[model samples]
Target: MEFTQLLERRRQRWTRFALLFTLFLVFISGLYLVVGEVFISPLEELSALEEQLILQLRLPRLLAALAVGASLAVSGAVLQVLLGNVLAEPGVLGISGGASVLMVLVLFFAPALATPFGFMLAAVIGALAFTILLVFIAKSMCLTTTRLLLVGVALGILSGAVVTWAFYFSDDLSLRQLMYWLMGSIGAASWYHHLLSLILLPVLIWLCCKGSLLDKLMMGEQHAKQLGVDVDQARWQLICAVSILVGGAVALGGVIGFVGLVVPHLLRLALGSENRYLLPISALAGAILVVLADLIARTALDSAELPLGVVTTSIGAPIFIWMLVSHHDSR
Candidate 1:
């Protein structure tokens, strides 16, 4: 019963952490709104100009940060289970690459489809297509571990090649725009873009609720089958859900890397890979991370904002390297 007590205490601690994290998310979100170029106090009555800035600019950007963060984190958590790799994330696995390629093509060649709704739609299609291809290739070849990661890396490289070619032929104006986006920023976010992204909320909820299914999948296919799970059907469903999440995030935030890779991995380490805890916590932590990153991106320099990706990469890369080293040492 000592073991049981230990488990119970651990659960209690995590429950407290989750509650604190939720409040932290709210606090940071409020902080994000008021702490920009013109600091607005929460207690003070808003001026018309302050109202416009908060509602039109800060609010929407905050929403985008929340959505992108939660989506990528949850997707990473699920992909880690599905691929059986701590390293699986939207960017690393080329899911974001797929969405990026389509977005670039559309913005360059079919500029008419560059609207908020159109870009979202294109990104979903691209992500879904690439996810389907990934699943098919993995299944046909029975890819596991290193082979699967190599395949994902290869896919990412191919997408990069296509995007590079597009960049080569683009005009200077278009090239500049694409470069900024590829580096990732929510500085241009507006209500319309956030609204388009919100449509993915239901899908995100559905994914978070799949914790039990992921728990089963984590045990391997034959074992999951023994437990009456339709492993193939479930795999496809999870893949599709991840595609939508990754696509929506890429559409809204442009290829913000490492939120996915880092958040869930950290949570799994702390929370012991019990996905019901891991997934939801991952979402909250991811949202907090991105919002904070966005805040730093905009406020770090008086004259100019940094790219969102640059901030996250700077933060995530060292942790990622640490993870690599720790994993190797453990092995």
Candidate 2:
């Protein structure tokens, strides 16, 4: 009878998960059809101009946004689990900032190599450097997740300084490009850019397979090891996977922040901290949020498109403050 009940519960859980995923997919498809400077309806379409706009432009941009969103959210979920911090996110922890700095340098100093592939490589190197530093500092100082966030902020500040200096010496065109990149815009997305990040979907699957290990790690390093998980190996693999994910994401969509932090935290709050479910669900939710945000960014104003980061940060900042306050009150 106990086994029967357990199986029934598992079936229910899967049903709910499937519904959630399907709802998001529907929203994405619906939004893709109607969002932009022009309105498109899936119900009726027979214009070559509309066909060109939808197929040539909007589809690639939407796909890139989806890929970037999923990558950032899953990376955020993994980092939060690894660090035991709900607030752990690539943008918040300087991973994206580090990548941004490298991208700027490459754009100015090596314009010939400033292709999508080139930027992806540069961003990966930068993200990996920050991730390594983060792991080293956490281990050496034995810092709690909350305190480690301060270190993350310091790294962000350092990256900001570099970006500022780069801006000071750059030309007008360079400055404009840098500003757009830093603020996050998917306006320039193409099929190649989408592929650059979407190709890393396998890495996401590999991370999902490690969900059990991450759940164990949440108990503590010693506890994880006792559970037969290789703590060191898991940590390296998780961080490296995240760096690759973030690198590709930032290369495709620039340094969009808070999707990672907000999506996972919201999921854990609504459901439970089951890493097995949280990671993939968070990926889907993140994709939905980014697509919705992009739609708003493009259509919110008549004269100008808002920065993608601006929309996300505007929405996320309040939730972030609420989380901090909730943490404080709980303490």
lDDT of 1 by residue, 242-284 (tens): 8889888988898888899999998877768888778888899
Candidate 2: worst 10 consecutive residues by lDDT?
Answer: 6-15
Steric overlap count per candidate: 0, 0
Model 1, which residues run further than 4 Å from truth?
Answer: 1-7, 137-144, 172-175
lDDT of 1 at 5: 100
Candidates in order have lDDT scores of: 0.87, 0.85
